[model samples]
Every structure is written in structure tokens, then in C-alpha cells.
Target: MSKRRKRKPKHFRGVYALLVFPFAEDFHLLLDLMRRFSAAVRYAYNRLLEGKGREELKRQDDLLCTFFRLNTRHADDAVLKAQAVLDSARERGEDPRKVVFGGRKLFETLRRRHLSGKPLKELKREWKEKRQGLLYSRGDRTKGGNLNLRLEAEDGALWLRVNLGNGRYAWALVKTSHPNLSALVERVHASLPYNVELSLKDGKVHATFTWEEEPTPLAATKENGVLGIDVNSDPYHLALAVVGPDGNLKRHLTLSLEEVDRAPNRGTKELLLWKIAHQVVSLAEEHGVAVATERLKHLPKGRRGDGSGRAFRRKQHRFAYASLLRKVHSLARKKGVQVVEVNPQDTSAIGMLKYAPLLSLSKDVAAAYVIGRRALGFKEKLPKGYGKLLRDERFRDHAQGFYASRVRELQAKRAQEQNPYLRRRLSREIGEAKRHLSLLSSLQGSPGSQREVTDGRNSPGVNPWRVLRVGTFLPLLGREVPRDLSPLKVFLHRGAWEGWRESRGPHPGGGPKRANVHFG
Candidate 1:
């Protein structure tokens, strides 16, 4: 068997520290430098986009230095900062011209400050601090670490010296009680290279130290087992499953993201996410198994102006799926834990169809289990029960009929609906129902591997799995993706798929058009 290709083991680490200025003059001086540095960065960003190189912009007599009252090193740092920002924007496919010096959201919030019940002065102050109060200094190995802003460790404590330009320097105490600061202490004492960044927020100055290191060797292995994770947005939770070497579930659990939702501020929320990431990585370390997660694709956060309910939009916005995954992947690498990204195709559908009812696991947990199994190179075969149901002609017809009835009812509802939002919602459901009708119309006589089949339905593809999901989830269950799928267990038994009887007569509560599903 071929071993997995190992990537370069590069580590990025950082710790936070608060800067305590001794004298008021020193505070004011540093604040002035930071505000100028912030302005210089924005100016440099625009200049960089105009094709101006750093060599011309970072000279001591250059306008960037003279106008900003910045030293040559600070001017150079500004250009570097601008280039980093530009590179990040391009990576995210964002319009570099539209980049806001201050965060766009924060700037936008100032316009509607009255709605937040906060004083306008306070709101503007927050915006100004973010937009103007910033400073950065890159470390140089030749200068015994950072040149413009060097860290010093004395008697188990840290201090920072800020070069104030014009032959002046100010010393400030680094206030942090973090236990891991010992590693930083050691690095500072050894004069290892480190980058320092300072920013003002909430009327206080905060500092972050960043450095690179070699990552540890991987200790966890797939041969031991795999810990699979799946993030769900609706309820906002992470479902995890520990699959053994034999592809059987050894354990399962879930971590709630409600606390992250309830956090009062962005800082607290970010800290909570990091805490959760640590818990996940710690579990993998304890199990001595590699972690498995799906390669994420861009998920549409429902537009608030249309399409989605307020609650749904809020959930999607706060999902943190990508954020938590990054934390887990990065932390795992630093700690020498194995991580595997599997193709996310059909993990959800396969789990809902087979394991959700078979093992009585929730849909999310079942999906996680499938991820772990796939990571171990196990293939999913269509269950015998599902294979038999797929071939049942009556089953296919009954499922098709359910959607056909739904489409008629939905179109009538949409026409009568006065509210635009409700009409749009109805129209969407009708479209889905019609699509299912088309899918069922082209059902094959036998189940086979997933492949494309076209027959005037304008469908790109049809497979046994899609047909089964389309037939069962909405037709008999009346839900596209129900939270509790144990109800599907009954249909998993013999003759259950085609075994549903429906009354076409007038319904007891509504009308004759509604078909009441009854499982026999």
C-alpha cells in the first residue's frame, strides 16, 4: 500500500498580550504612531494596486514616511501590510478596489447606530479605532528578533520596546497570564524571530505575537481508527463519530454551538470556537486515531432580503463550519494529529437512507460515520432492502403520484397567496415537486451504480440513491430532511416502500386534493 504524501510541516503560532503604558505621554505617543501607521497602510494599499513597488515607497525621505511621521522600518512594514491585505482579497475573489480600511460591517453599523440603542459617539469611536489604530513590525533574525518592536523576557515576564522614530523609544509591560506564555518566554530569551502587531480596540491597546515553527510528527494513524466530524447549520452543532479499523462505530457524540451563538461579542465568540477546536483535537489525540472531515464547499447563506426565513439566515450566518474546521485542521497539524479530507458527495444521503434507521443514529451522526468509513477506504453498497424497493414498479408510481399531487396543490396556493415571501416559498416547493416528478418518471427497472441518464426531463443525472431519497423522504415522510429519521426504519422492512396507501377522497380536515399518507 502507498503511504500518504507528506506536506511541508510549517507551523504558525501566536499569543495575545495587553500593552500597559506607564506614562500618559508614552500612551499618547504610541497612539499617534499607530494612527499614522494605519493611515500609511491604507495609502500604501492604494499605491500597491497602482503598481508602485516597496523599494520606492519605503525610503526614509519618501512621502509615506515624511507625511506619516513613520521611521523607514515602519514605512516598510506598512507596504508589507498592504501587500498582505491585497493578496488576501485576491485569494477570496473580492474586489480589491472595494476594500474598506475599516470593516465594512462596522462602518455600515454606524449609519444605523440609533437602532442598536448605543450612543452614536461610542459607535463612531469603535469605528475610528478599527480604522486608524494599527501597527505592525516584522522580525529580523539579524536584529535578534523584531527590529522595530523587539520583545524582552526578564525574570519570567515580557516587555515590549516600541521604536518611536527620531531617536526615541518607549517601553511597555506585556500583561498576560496565559500558561503557554512559557514557550514565548523561551523564544524571546533565545532571540528567535517573531512578528509583532498592535491594534487598539475598546479604548485599549492589544498586541499579538506571531512566529513560525516546525510542526510535530504525526502520531495518530488511520490504522488505529478515524474520528469523523460533520457540521450542521440548522441546529448549529458538530456531530462526531469514532469509527474503528473494522469500519464499525466505536462511539458518537455532538458538540452544541449555542454558546458560540450566545456570545456577547466577536472576541468571546472567537475564543469559544477555539476552545471547541481544542476539545475535538484532544479527543483525536486520546483515541490515537486520525481525524476525518469533509472538504467543504461554499454553502449559500439564505439572502435576508428574500428566499429564507430570518431564523434560517441567522443560523447560516453563524454556522462557523468553515471557521471551526480551520481551527481543527490547524491545531491538529501543530499537535501531530492526522487529518483527512474526504469527498463530501452523498455522505448525507447515504447515511439518511441506510445507517440512520439501521443503527438508530441521528442523520448528522450517521453522516459522520459514513465519512469515517469512507476515509478508511470502505465502499457503501446499496442495502438489499433498498435495492428491492428501487425495483418495485408500484413504489416508483406511488412516489411519483405524491409529488404530482403536491405540485398541483402548491401552484394553486401560490396563485392565491398575497404575500410575496409566502408565494416565493410556495413556488420553490412546487419547483422541487416537479423536479422529483421528472426524476421518478425516468426511474430504471434495476438499481445500479450512480450514473447520468437523460430522458426529456432536462435532468443532468439520475441514480438509484437519488431516486430512493426522492421517493421516500418527501412522499411518505412529508419532509425533505427530517431531524428524526427513525420513522424510516418501518419502510426499511419488507414490502414497505410500495406499501403506502393514500386516500384520494376528501380529507377529514381540508379538501379532496390533499392525499393523506397511510403506511400499511
Candidate 2:
């Protein structure tokens, strides 16, 4: 097997809770330890950039212990944190020499504080707290959850035991609104490993507990059936389809995610996503079927000023596919449901051309149907109707003619349009029309059993589905994604070369031409 790609660790996103300490203990002592730990982290970071390894740094951690007044454990964790920061900077393609432990944003804020009418003293205080108010202790399985810091359950409430240097320890009552604190407690009781983090935010101390959770063995299997999920952006809903083992649609439904968009804050929105994830898993468990979803990629949001980049970000900001999918995957694992990720390529087009009209299902639901079938290890063959449409010379000509007219129209407008943005938009349309014309023009010979058409050297291995998608959708139906796909029913059953559609001469653009509403 090839080398596996490194991904984010499978640990849970940790829980942050308020730390309430006893009045008798000196909180400043905790503050002093935090200051030393922060200094060691920065020192180790600089040393790492000079080519020092972790083990080398740890062996001579006496320099950190003596200089920062920290113990061996704190010194070790400081090296770990510094290594993490360096690795992250390299991953993001940044120079490690310019790495700022306190954050560059805080430095910039000092310059902007006068404009915002905020006091310089307060800004400085905030910056200082950010730099020195961090503490971290990694867990050791041999040491029962943690070494320097530990969580002890006492009287139904969780309290943190913090180690101060030279045989001194401090305790703080850990209070959290998060419901998963019990899971942390369970790990602590079982002597399983768990990491601890403490940071001061606005004078209040907070503790974070994190661990990698092992998933339960999958109960639901694809042998029973598959439930495919499609998250649509425009309507802001999740479309689901239940496909039987034989690859036939059993039932389908949609769950609205509009409430997540309307949420007032990030935390609330995350909670809402988790709730939606629960519902999806519950459905899978109820049907005893594995879940299937698109294996989406992380495409970079390009820099602004480029027309395509701006357009990409505008649409991307309005949806939450990855975040929601991660939640779904995490919840499914815990619930003992299997989740199969399928390649999203052509699933949309295949659904639009084949199943939409045949099953009278919506486009999103049809795509879900394709996903379910694919997860069951089924290869999608071209439908007979669509295959026949590709072989029809008249149909291909009509499609090419429509795109030719569109290209001419866009080029005409692009010449006269004064606005650069509008001209750029017109250029994009012109390029799209020319591309469609190219694809349709490339179809030379008759498609065989596989219905594969050689799309020429420029575009190789063009299948019937692609040509059918380009040929039928905009040319026959008059819209890329028509609000009413019922019109495609005729193309599906009767024939793709519609006489009435082709009889109407191609308008300037894809839409119908009308003069004063085509009558007045």
C-alpha cells in the first residue's frame, strides 16, 4: 500500500469549563507557573527553528528548568507545544523565524487601539495575558490520565489537581455546562490517557480536557441497505434516500438546516449541527442500514479580485458541507452505524439526466439515490434513453447550435459593456458556451456497448452521460438547472431530439426571446 496521508488526530474537540478554585489557595502561584511555561514554550520554539530535536531539547531541559523555573514535565510539554507550533507554521508555508507566541494580531491591535477609543493600558494588559496565561500538560497512560494535572471526582463534582514546582500542589473545582465531562471522568476512572489545558480569559481560568475516543463496532451494514445523504446549499436542507440492497429506492426525506444559518453565534450553530447529525444517525439505526455521503475535498478559497475566486467564496460561505459531514461521521461512529464515502464526480449529472424524470424525484434526492447505489459497490451504466440520444446526429447539432448562438450573444455584449466586472462575467459565459460547443463538436463516431465517445485529444474519454447532460439540459429544457424538470420527461420517454424545441430558433442567450413580452 502507498504511504497514508496525515490527517488531523482523531481526538475529540475538547471541552472548556470554568475553574473555581478554593479561597485558601494562592491563585497567583498558578499564574506564576503559567508565565514560566509560556516562556519555556517560546524558548523551545526558537531552539527548534535552529535544528534541535525534541529528545535533544528534553535532555538539556535543565536550561529551560533553570531559566524559566519549570520542572521536567513542564519542560517536556513546552518542547511538544513548540514543535506543534513549528509544524503548523511549516504546513501553512510560513517562515518559522517570524513566529510570534503572543499572536501578531495583538501587536497590530496596539496600533488600532487609538482609533477604536480603547485605552492603551487595557490593550497592553490583554496582550500580556495572551502571552503568559497558557498552561498545558500531556496525559500518560502509565500515570493514570495525566502526570502534572489530574481530574479527581469528589462529591459528584470534578476538581482539577495542579502540580506546582517543589512538591506543592493546588486544586480548582472544575465546573462546565458541557455534558461530555462525564466521558472525561470515565477515562480518568479507567486510568485512560487524557490531556489537560488551562488558559486565562478575562481573569477567569478555564480547563480543557481532550482524548482520542475509539469508535464502537459497526452494527448497521450495507448488506441490509444504504441511506445516502446530500447536503444542498440553495434550499439549505439535507436530502436523504433509502436504497435497498438491490439498488432500488425504498424511501426518501429532507431535513431543513436553515436554522443553523440563522443561529446567532458560532457555538449555537455547532450545537445545531450536532443535533442534525443525531437525527441522521437515528434514521440509519432505525432502518438498520449504513450511511453514504459525498467525499468532498477541501478546495482553497482563492484570493479576491479574480472574478472566479470572488464567485467561489460568495457561494462557499453560504454552505457548511465539511463541518456538517465531520459531525455526521463522528456521530455515526459512536452510534455504531457504518458510513461510506463515495466519489462525488458525475453523481449530480447522472441523477439529473436519468433518475430525475423516471422516478419523479427531485434532483437532490436523485443524487442521493446514485450515492446509495454506488456505496453498495454498483457501477452506474448509462440509461438506454440517454444512450440513444447521444447517437442521434440531429440532437447533437441542435445542442451545438444553441451554444453557438449563446457565444455570439455574450461576445457582442462583452464588447459594448463598460463595467470591467460585467465584461468579466460575460467573458466567463462566452468561455462556457465555447466549451460546450467544443465538447459537442468532439463527438465523432458511434458509441459502442459502453456508450463511450472519444472527446478528442483536448478532452479524452467523454462518456454519453456528459454529452447528454450538456445536450439535453440547456438546449432542450432552456435552463441549466430548471425549476421544473418535468419538461425532461418528454426527452426521457419520447425522444431527446424534440422537434418543437429545435423548431424554435436559438435565441441570443439560452432563455427564450421576447419582444415587449413576445406579443406587445
Candidate 3:
């Protein structure tokens, strides 16, 4: 046997930190610089979109450097930022022609916002409203440009020197009174960040840095175990469950989210989110395990046509799952914990159905338990009721067989019927029976994967078979499925496939094989 190749370990992890700046007289100059930078970036973006070739865009970048009177490096930065946005949109399947930004959207792009403590959902709304002006700027990543910031030792006092664009400098004293000042300054001095940002908030200057720290990547396997987190609303913000490699629950934790849930102010909500992030990181560190959470996606805007109240709609909008995940992942990385995301499908229902009774835990904790098991590559056993539903001979074999037999009978009747209208009716009935046979066969083989069974259905907690209840399951007692079974079925007077259809003829077979019928 050949030797196995060793996988390379990931090294650098990103960190965001804030440093305060003080200025009394040059505040107006700082604002002026922000406006000019924003204008230049917007112009470059529009020009980039209009250009058809990469070489042509490079030519335009050179012209912008002259027209904007910006340094060559700074002008190149603007072009790169524009290209990054266009590339991202294209990757997401968005049309490039419709991706133009204007109004408040353009100004919002001027800020280095990942460092902002605001929840991403709220920040997005504010970004799209009027002009919030520039609260921050991620200036050129080089050593000499606007974002070039360094802590200098002068006259035995710690001072921060920031290069404002247009070859200007602003100095601020590092106040010894601030609790985190020493730590912040020491980190910057050690890392010497490549990119820096300047922010003007509450009439005070602040500098933001995106630095890379030494990485402590986890091993390929963690025998100690995994941490599963379920993010939810109300009294408990998150439910965390730790499970061993053997798939047994080790511990359960609930983070109280009362303050964030009840907060009326956006700032307070943001602060509470920070505290939650810290808690998650601390827990992961204490356990020395990998972190896991549900990978939620394609969230609907609201309960469409469901008659949900205004308060309910507003509450749905305020819960930002993506932002909270970002915070937790970032903090966990800093502490050397590996983060894992598992598919969110059926996690809540499966937990409630299988593990809740055995562990005597709430549904949320049980769901977290399922998530942990998923991350560990362990299979969760189906509930006993689910197995019984699948094993029922009527559902597994007889229902589909009935439809198939009825389809054959109708085909024979269509051939014998003399009246034109009666022949057409027989043909239609045969087509309907064939279609139902296909659907039932699909379910018997793979119940949840069939388009007819899963389409337009979003009820997560209900049993999959129950969605086909009433007209579908009840039809077994009678000769035909009720009219209500197909709300959209039209009167099919024509034969199957209508006019000029290719025929492969019929199958020479016995009742479709025993292996296909029984799922156990």
C-alpha cells in the first residue's frame, strides 16, 4: 500500500480590534477626506462595470489616478474593491447589469464595517437609508498610505500616528486610564497590521485594525468530543450540547438571552451579542472541543399569506442568525477551536422525535445533541413510529400496486369503449392512475426525495407522510382518490402526452421486484 499524504494545517486567523483617536481642530479635515474617498471609490466602481475587458479597466484605473489626484496605490485599491464586489455578486448568481449601487448604498461601502459591533441586519437597514456619511475607511494596506497607523514612543508618552489621505497626519495620545488600552496597543505593535481603518464615532476618532494572529488549528480528530449549539429566540438565546466520540451526551448549557431579547435599543442588543460571543468562546476553550451549529439558509422574508400579525413579522426580521454565527466563529477561532456547520434539515423534528424522551431534555437541547452527532459523522436512528409508518405494507407495496393495476384496467376500457366522450374519459383516468402510481412508487423507494411529495411543503415538525393525508392515504378504501386530492388537475380530455408522442412501448415484467417494495 502507498503511504498516505499528510494534510497541511491552516495557520493565520483574522482578528478585529478598535483603537481610539483624539483630535480637536482637524475634525473637519477628516470628514472632507472621507467624502472625497467615497466619491473616488464610487466612480471607479461604475467605470469598472462599464468596461468589457480587464486590460481596458486597468487603463481606466490609470486615468482615475490622474483625475482623482490620488496616489497610484490608493487608486489601484479603489479598482480592486470594485472588482471584488462584482466578482462576489456574479458568484452568487446575480446579474452583473443589475448590481449597480447608488444613494445610501454607495456611502455605506466606504466603511470598514466588519469591525463594527452593530448587528449586520440592522446595519444593513441603516446603510440603505439616506446618507449616514462615512463612519470609517479601510485605507490602502501599504505602509505609507492613509491607513498607515503605528504606535510611536515620543517623550515617554504613547502616541498613535495616522496618515490621513492627501499626505496628512493626525496624532492621538493613548490614554492610560482605558482598561484595554495596553492590550490593544501591544497587539498592534506586535502584528504591524497590513490594513488599517479610521472611524469617527460619537465625535471621537477610532482606528480599526484587521490583523492575523498565530493559528492553533485542531487535529484531524478530536477524541475529547464536539460542542453543538442551537441558536433560537426568547428566554434562552442558545442551547449548547457536548457529545463524546461514542455519541453520548456529555453536557448541556443554556445561555440566558433575556437582556438581548428585551432590549429596546440597538446598541444594547449589540452589547448583549458581544457578551454571548464571549460566553461561547469561553465554553469551547474549557471543553477543548470542536464547535458545531446548524447551517441555516434561504430564510423567507415573512409568513407569506399566513395572516401573521405585525409584531410577529417585526420579531422575525430582528433575529439575525448569520451575524451571531459570524461572531461565534470568529471568537472560537481566536481560542483555537475548530467550527463545524451541519445541514439544518430535520434537526429540530428529529431531536424532538427520538432523543427528547430518552435524555429527558427539552427539544432545543435534543436538537443540539443531533447537531453534535451529525458533526461527528454519527447516524441518528429514526423514531419507532417513523419506522412503523414506512414498514406498513399498504404504503410500501399495495398502494402503488393498486394504482398500477387501475391504470391497466383503464387502458383496456379505453380500447373497448365505443362512445367518443367515454373513450376520452377512460384515457384521462388511465393517465391519472399512472401519475399516482409514479408518485407512490417514488415515496416507497425514497419517501422524502420525490418532487410530488416534498414540493410546496414547508411544515418542518409534521411527519412527511402526513402531508399526503386525507385524499391521498384515504383513497385506499375506495376505487378512486377524491377530487380534492388534486386541486390543480385540469380535465384531461386528450390522451397521455397529447399529440405526436414517441412510444417506447410497454414493459414485459412481473409486479416490480420484491427488493423494490420493502424498505427495511
Stretches off by above 4 angstroms in model 1 are 1-9, 109-118, 233-236, 256-275, 303-307, 384-388, 441-460, 483-520
Q: Rank the candidates by lDDT, best first.
A: 1, 2, 3
Instruction: Name the 10 consecutive residues with the lowest summed lDDT in model 2.
Output: 511-520
Per-residue lDDT of 75 in model 2: 88
Across residues 178-259, which tens digit of lDDT does each residue of candidate 1 receive?
6668887777888888999999999899999988988788899888999999999867889999999999999999999899
Error of 2 at 144 (Å): 2.5
Measured on C-alpha atoms, candidate 3 has an lDDT of 0.57
lDDT comparing candidate 2 with the true structure: 0.79
TM-score of each: 0.85, 0.83, 0.62
- What residue pairs are clashing in model 1? none
Q: Over all chains combined, what TM-score does candidate 1 have?
A: 0.85
Q: Residues 1-520, candidate 2, lDDT per residue (tens digit)?
A: 9999998435364677998878555577888899889888998998888898877777644678788878778889999999999999999898989888788988887766554445776678788888999899998999988989988888898888889978898888988978787778788789888889899778888888888776678899899999999998757899999999999999999999889989999999999999999999999999999999998867455445545645456555758889999999988878888889988877887787778888988989998998898889887766666666776777777778777877876798899999887787678778887888887887756333245322111123465677777776677666666545665666566555553365554333343341111100
**Residues forming the 10-long window of minimal summed lDDT in candidate 3:** 485-494
Candidate 3 off by > 4 Å: 1-25, 51-61, 99-184, 187-191, 199-206, 219-221, 234-236, 301-306, 383-385, 393-520
- Which candidate gets the maximum TM-score versus the true structure? 1
Each candidate: RMSD: 5.1, 4.9, 14.3
